[model samples]
Target: MAVHGRTEAQPIDLTQVRAYGDTLNDGAIALSFSLPVPYGDEAKEAARQLVRQMGLHDPQVYHAHDLGEGYTWLLVYAKSPYSVDFTKISVPKVSNHKLSHAAIEDYWHEHGGGEKLRVIGACTGDDAHTVGIDAILNYKGWRGDKGLESYKCFAVKNLGAQVENDRLLAEAAAFGADVILVSQVVTQKDCHRTNLAALVDLAEAEGARGERIFLCGGPRLSHPIALELGFDAGFGPGTVPSDVASYLVQAVVQRRRENAQPI
Candidate 1:
């Protein structure tokens, strides 16, 4: 229980915690969604009543817009009367160790010596979104971080969007790439899954198993999902060039050591 804008000192319980909006434990919340109903007075009332039915109190319909053809988008603010066990929640994540752009280049040159690490990246399948891959591989980083292209140590080959998995594998073989990066942005009907899986399966069919590193990245990609899909790693939202560069360079160094090659 709370008043005004402060939390009332109560027993700390993570097992069941309510949302905090105007005050601590207030259970206040906000949500926006599109409903199948047309926008009108009835739609607003429907939204308010809907929130109330969900155990929320003081439901307020903030905004509602008709999205044409009997569809309405709405924003609602209300107080929820439920909570969950925060202590039992866990999410898998990628590498905790991130390398600087300079560090990545320095490590590659100092470790790899004469051979520059070759990396091939592409947006395989019918997904033609190049923005994601371009941001990581292009020199002018997407949101401020310089891409792998800016790094002097890596030989990056970005084949752009809508590349075929078989072509990617052929290029990987011809280029003798040390890392294979696949990006899929169009996830309509979970097509990213099928496209990414095809790349992995094709690489295996080509007998390139255990040779180069396989990495998948996109908005829908996750480390756990990538691992399960037979990839060495996966990169998702907010992933910068340095993060991918760090992992690939480190993995390459490890591989070099395992092969008794100087790195």
Candidate 2:
């Protein structure tokens, strides 16, 4: 296809272009989502037919397994015959430096140690999941790295699940905490957002909002949403203790520098 008075050329923006052929092109994508079905060849054929009916071509079931009693799981690949303008989409992002655990420890040592920086963590509001919070503050490590308990300068107080916002704030004040880490595991009915918001509100009411590094972690929490909800950072699943520890120590140092406070 040649344009008049011009040589043949490809589109500068190939964002919305979809290629059609047997080979996987740049537009090709593999998708995996669960559907309640029995594990069998019938289920696999049904999945392929469903994707084909949805306009995808060459749908192939790579693997299928029985999730449990009467439940099935699948991984499939197919050529999607759809495309969208990538330039038309936008997303929020969190901007923060990525530092290793060694760098963080070095920074703490250089800044001055033995100050006993306090941190309070809990799983707030009727949510009984302590695994996330424990992974951050407990003596044991997660994913082959030492937790905050290994840091000599940190005084970590982990208040377990179902904690109230008022209680958290009161304890923070009492302990003169430098940071507060909140973990929410239950997002059922949007309860996680509500509880997170309430904690922020309570911290503001107690005049300790800006005095500490407020962080939240869960399977669904993100940095953008956390920033929007007034958190310094939000960590999701697969987050280890060192990640949170690194962030907290750096945040404290940054805050002190910004405030020009002598420590």
Q: Can you give the TM-score per candidate against the true fold?
A: 0.79, 0.70
In model 2, which residue pairs have backbone atoms overlapping below 3 Å? none
Q: List the residue pairs that clash in candidate 1.
A: 111-263
Off by over 4 Å in 2: 1-14, 17-96, 112-114
**Segments in model 1 whose C-alpha atoms lie over 4 Å from true places:** 1-5, 8-12, 41-60, 78-82, 205-209, 255-263
| RMSD, candidate 2, Å | 6.9
Using lDDT as the measure, the top candidate is 1
lDDT of 2 at 98: 59
Candidate 1 C-alpha lDDT tens digits along 1-263: 45555646656578987897776677889988888998899898888888888888998888999999998999999988889999999876665468887888788778887788999999989988899999999999778999888888888899988899889988988998999999988889989998888777877887885788899999989999998888888999998888898998888888778878755
Per-candidate Cα RMSD to the true structure, in Å, reads 3.6, 6.9
Alpha carbon lDDT at 226, candidate 2: 90
